[model samples]
Target: MNVSINIKWPLIILLMLPFTLAIGCLIQIKHFAPEPLILKKDEIFTLPSGTNYAGLEKLLRRQHLAKKTCWLPWLIKLEPKLAEVKAGTYRLQPGMTVRDLLNLLVSGKEAQFSIQFIEGERLKEWLTVLSRAPYMKHDLHDVTPQTLGVKLGDPADSILEGEFYPDTYLYTATTSDSAILKRARQRMKLMLLKIWEGRAEGLPYETPQELLIMASIVEKETAIKEERARVASVFINRLRAGMKLQTDPTVIYGISEDYHNSITRRDLMTPTPYNTYIINGLPPTPIAMPGQASLKAAAHPEESEYLYFVADGRGGHVFSTNLASHNQAVRKYRQGHDIRGNNE
Candidate 1:
């Protein structure tokens, strides 16, 4: 009887050992699952492509992100979907648990980065900004305005300046720079067409391109929202009266690399397709990228007799109906200002 009891007790102990180990493993998993990842602040974690569960386990262990990640293999086995981790950059925040990290890796929602194209800036500036942006695929090598315009499917004669809408664009890792520019161009085309269709009547502009050119001028003239229409009116009134636009921004655009934060008398007198001081009508192309407000203002200018404007020595401009008033305003606010002899 004693021998049978002893044999039965050893068999029972052996049977319970497996269950005990399983329960202990379950307890361990539960304890570690909710523990916070070893991060003081938000961190950027990148998982390379083709990495599987084993690779992920090795990475977590090597990075020391968790105190006890030896059970990760078992965890992944229990939840087979966790093994399917997508490759991309991820922003891991503090207080996130191991389970949360696993869920994020499988969610495939990679971190988003942004690039801003500012209004009144040229296409070259936008390209520079795009080139410096992180994680972008730089496909535009030796890019020029003409080449870029062709890539955007624009007309052979189309100028790329002011073609792209100035706004913040969001992109994921490995996104091409050209892709962002394409989106901006598409947005600009749609918005410009919409605004052109609803433009005010009796305007001097013959086409949507003319309106865009005027909008770019207005964008460079004044940044104040309230003054945009007034600025646009000055140019439109000039176009109607057959007077020279005589705008400084157009001359600067003509000067291009030669402009050194200040325009010289020679620059104003120089003859270029974009030089409005010497040119009869609107410049051949837009000077800079115009925002929505400038586009709207150029489409619908305020009803006024103003034909000239000069810097008001403030963040605004002084509009005038005639040369005398404009010269007087320029003399008062901007003494020795570079005003055109015939007009302002």
Candidate 2:
């Protein structure tokens, strides 16, 4: 044993070179390959708050993403600048690589969800939509609208109906219904203030709240975008002339809880705080949430002498400047006249 043969260190190093290079290449391939957490579009993956590299490796191994546990170490050592991965629910595409997944995780961009509040929807409808929205934490189901309004910093006498802006709201998985409502409420206040500042001169509205009430009525009256300004003008003219609004939407809203199918003559004659046919001024509160377009129309109505309008037997309306023309238009509508061709 003492008389050992001389062995060259270079030869030993050369013999080991190929194996080391092979391992290095395999690690590189695995690092650049598709991610271990890649899932289908409908599938979700969650990483707990304190998940570390070791935990991630085990999870990948369980998912059969790698043949061995050596690649993660190499990847991590190579990219030391990558921050610690955040903890949250994530969705990964099929083609995402390990590098891409790591980048997404470290950037702390969690999954985003959307909830929509449609224009002209009632507060009841909004609550239903919120309760049914996916991933929304519904804690306000038992809360009354008045209570919610107070929590939103509205006046003690304020009604919650139509106070929130209608639009698509973005939130995280844990966002509460109250949080979304708060944001929408603030947005609505801002929008109302801006529109109020740009309102047309000599308008009949004495306050922003009155303008909102009018806007809500306009929203419910017509689905046609071109008719909004004209509809607003008709209401404004009626207000200026001290005439009853006589709008069907307000009557329907007054009895919405018991409304079944059609409006009866008796219903129009019935008096309520919201019955424009019987009330001298705007309703006590808004009937439904109005979109920005309706709000704008209410703020700056088309200047016209039109005091009355009737459905033109189409998806629009016919405007008239006097009761006689309005009565004639009503007769035409009753007689199934095709007034669409005559309306501009």
Best by lDDT: 1
lDDT measured at residue 220 in model 2 versus the true structure, 0 to 100: 95
RMSD of each candidate? 4.0, 4.7
- Which stretches of model 1 miss by more than 4 angstroms? 1-12, 153-158, 336-344
lDDT of 2 by residue, 1-344 (tens): 43342356667788999999988877675655444544444444566789887787776667654445546756666666543888876666665667767787788787788889999989888888888877667888666655666656667767789889999999876788989998998999999999999999999888899999999999999989999999999999999999989898889888987777889999988888888888897888999999999999999999999999998877899999999999999998976754444554
Those runs of model 2 whose alpha carbons end farther than 4 Å from true positions after fitting are 1-43, 57-74, 77-83, 144-146, 151-157, 337-344
Candidate 2, run of 10 with poorest lDDT:
33-42
Q: What are the lDDT scores of the predictions, listed in order?
A: 0.89, 0.82
